[model samples]
Target chain A: QQQVKQSPQSLIVQKGGIPIINCAYENTAFDYFPWYQQFPGKGPALLIAIRPDVSEKKEGRFTISFNKSAKQFSLHIMDSQPGDSATYFCAAKSAGGTSYGKLTFGQGTILTVHP
Target chain B: GAGVSQSPSNKVTEKGKDVELRCDPISGHTALYWYRQSLGQGLEFLIYFQGNSAPDKSGLPSDRFSAERTGGSVSTLTIQRTQQEDSAVYLCASSFRTGGRDEQFFGPGTRLTVL
Candidate 1:
């Protein structure tokens, strides 16, 4: 079973627009959420992350809005640019477990920004 | 400040052949992980190693898949009797520690194609 589910397998947006990708998980034990960005033929890079303790966290143009009760989190890219075009992935990790540090990833979202 | 590095960025082999992929983590990192990313699929966890602890291999798809970390810095994932379904991008990542909050640095994945 997929532990984390993501929606909108592909997204297209004009430059300067905002692109939002959402993810949901059923495991309430997950406390750490992170987003990764990957370019073609490259590995995913850590974009931003958030802890369930806070409702939201923003870094530069990337923002993570997390709802602990709903077991959901979303990534919003403000002033999206053409360079932001890449595959985005949402992942979660349990704080305590034999599987600690093992991240469960969601289906990736391919975001394309048109100039 | 070197990042995680993977070898043989791309590999092509026939079915029933065995293949080995390697990863070199950043200096001094104590945690290493292997993940598989299939086309249009999420990053699937395969194995994890932290310090001298026993590796968590529960995520490995089958006995044909195995990995070893030597000297706590380099890792090699070996696949025996590969099949077409084994075709995917194998990714490696490393972190400073197994802490829930530590960011993972990923290497450019090794794309394996089984024909």
Candidate 2:
């Protein structure tokens, strides 16, 4: 079963636009959600993260809007630039039981910010 | 101080051969993980290690795929009887602790090609 599902296998946005990537999870036990960005030939890097308690969290131009009831979360990149073009992955984890810290990743989305 | 380091950025081997990929995590990080990314596929979890405990090998795709962490610092992924289907980028990541809740630091990854 696909525990996590992501949409828009690929995306393209003009510079300075807002690009949104959506992810949904099926397991209610998951509590932590994180977004990662990866460039070609590089490892995925932490971009932003959110917990269930908050509806939205923001850092700089990156924001994570989480919906607990919907079991969905989305990453928003404001002022998207050419440098923001890369692959994005969303992961979930449930730290409540022995399965704590085992991340279930969503199918990645490739973002292309046209300059 | 340096980020995670992986050896042999790229490798190519013939079918039925064996291959080994190495990963050196950040110093003092106790949790290590291995994942594989095939062409056009999402990151597939392979294995994980925490402290001295036996690894969680649930994600391993087959019996021919195996990984080990030595002294809780470095890890090696072994592919026996390499096949064309085994060609993919193997990624290694580390965190401050296990349970995948902590932010993971990923290496550049080793690209493997089996012909």
Candidate 3:
């Protein structure tokens, strides 16, 4: 399937807490997974990405944990802040065919971080 | 700015009308994609263009939705007989290439309201 399922339609967290968003895909052809962040009145932006080859990838306060065997992956914010409150999306992409690399995004998770 | 840009930041149209949204991708980028974002939902892939090859229109939701990229640069997405379901933010993204391509930069989406 081209669908990427995501969990927790919405989340609320306090400052310094960790907010986690999970995603799973059934298509084995998908090799690239990326996370995007969207704020009000703006477009989604590339936050971080990971390849199945690695189990984890970290950039700044964001980290991606991948479980290829289970066809699942997740994003963890090390220290959540009010500014980090936004809609987070998980997307999967395949190299050939299958929409020609167009990303298949999950139902986004709206995260709210209380200061 | 040097980033991807979109026109008609906000568009309100009556049902059964046709609306056109334009996008200007960054220079030197060869791939462009169109997506629809309904309220509180993930982005739905619509179409993508790669170089001189024919665009991948498989993601288009229906025959009323069409897109055109002229001179391999600017793109326009046209939605005919707009329905309330078509009320959403239309986003445009551009990447350096396709197939394991580089990061896609997104523009401030056009908020399309079909009344």
Candidate 4:
């Protein structure tokens, strides 16, 4: 019940194109969802996040769409540039748990934005 | 810089050798997390520390993995009798848990290669 499955292990899109990555989870206790972007030779950085109470949250060109009933979420990139190319990971974490709020990540999707 | 930093950016070790990865979390941050990312795989939560104490270690894959934090500051992850499967990027993150929604800041990561 701790797994977060992500789709499209690899995604390729042209510049200015929108790429959407989807993820699903089995644990219903997860209240917070976050998307992380990792570049070559660097650690993943927080791109954007959303809470289950809301359906969608946007930061700059990144958007997180959450579906509470379906136990799924997605990350959409608006006008994706080549600079946005990287491995994207979707993670979920519950509020209060023995896990100490450790994030459960998906398999990851390698996003390549072509110029 | 004030961001999280890791030492020995790259490491190449022979099989059966033990390796230790270090992490310096953001100053004054109370929470620290360790994650491992294999090639083309998503980040795996290894362990997390709350004020130098790890509450849950279920994420650790085997008995060969161990980690510790001191002074609520620096943390180290040690892999004993490393195998080919132990080769991966070890990333560290720190967060100030406010009991609400918190953001984790990640370090560049230490790449470990077992030959």
How many clashes in candidate 1? 0
Instruction: Give the per-residue lDDT digits (tens) of candidate 1, residues B1-115.
Output: 7899999899999999999999999999999999999999989999999999999898999999999999988999999999999999999999999776899999999999999
lDDT agreement with native, every candidate:
0.94, 0.90, 0.93, 0.89
**Superposed model 2: Cα runs more than 4 Å off:** A96-99
Q: lDDT per residue, candidate 1, A7-79, as tens digits?
A: 8899999999999999999887888899999999999999999999999999999999999888999999999
Query: Can you give the DockQ of every candidate in the order shown?
Result: 0.91, 0.67, 0.85, 0.73
Lowest-sum lDDT 10-residue window in model 1 chain B: B96-105
* Pairs in steric clash, model 3: none
- Residue B56, candidate 4: Cα error in Å is 2.3
Displacement of residue A71 (Cα, Å) in model 4 is 0.6
Ranking 2 against 3 by lDDT, winner: 3
In model 2, the Cα lDDT at residue A30 comes to 90
Regions of model 1 farther than 4 Å from truth: none
Model 3 residue runs over 4 Å out of place are none
User: Tens digits of per-residue lDDT for model 2 on B6-90?
Assistant: 9899999999999999999999999988889898777888898989988889888999999988877889999999999999999
Per-prediction TM-score: 0.98, 0.97, 0.97, 0.95
| Model 4 agreement with the true structure over B22-98: per-residue lDDT tens digits | 99999988988899999878889888887745445778999999988878889889999999999999999989962
Candidate 3 lDDT over A1-115, as tens digits, reads 4479998899999999999999999888888999999999999999999999999999999999999999999999989999999999999898876745699999999999999
What C-alpha root-mean-square deviation, in Å, does candidate 4 show against the real structure?
Answer: 1.5
Cα displacement (angstroms), candidate 3, residue B10, comes to 0.6
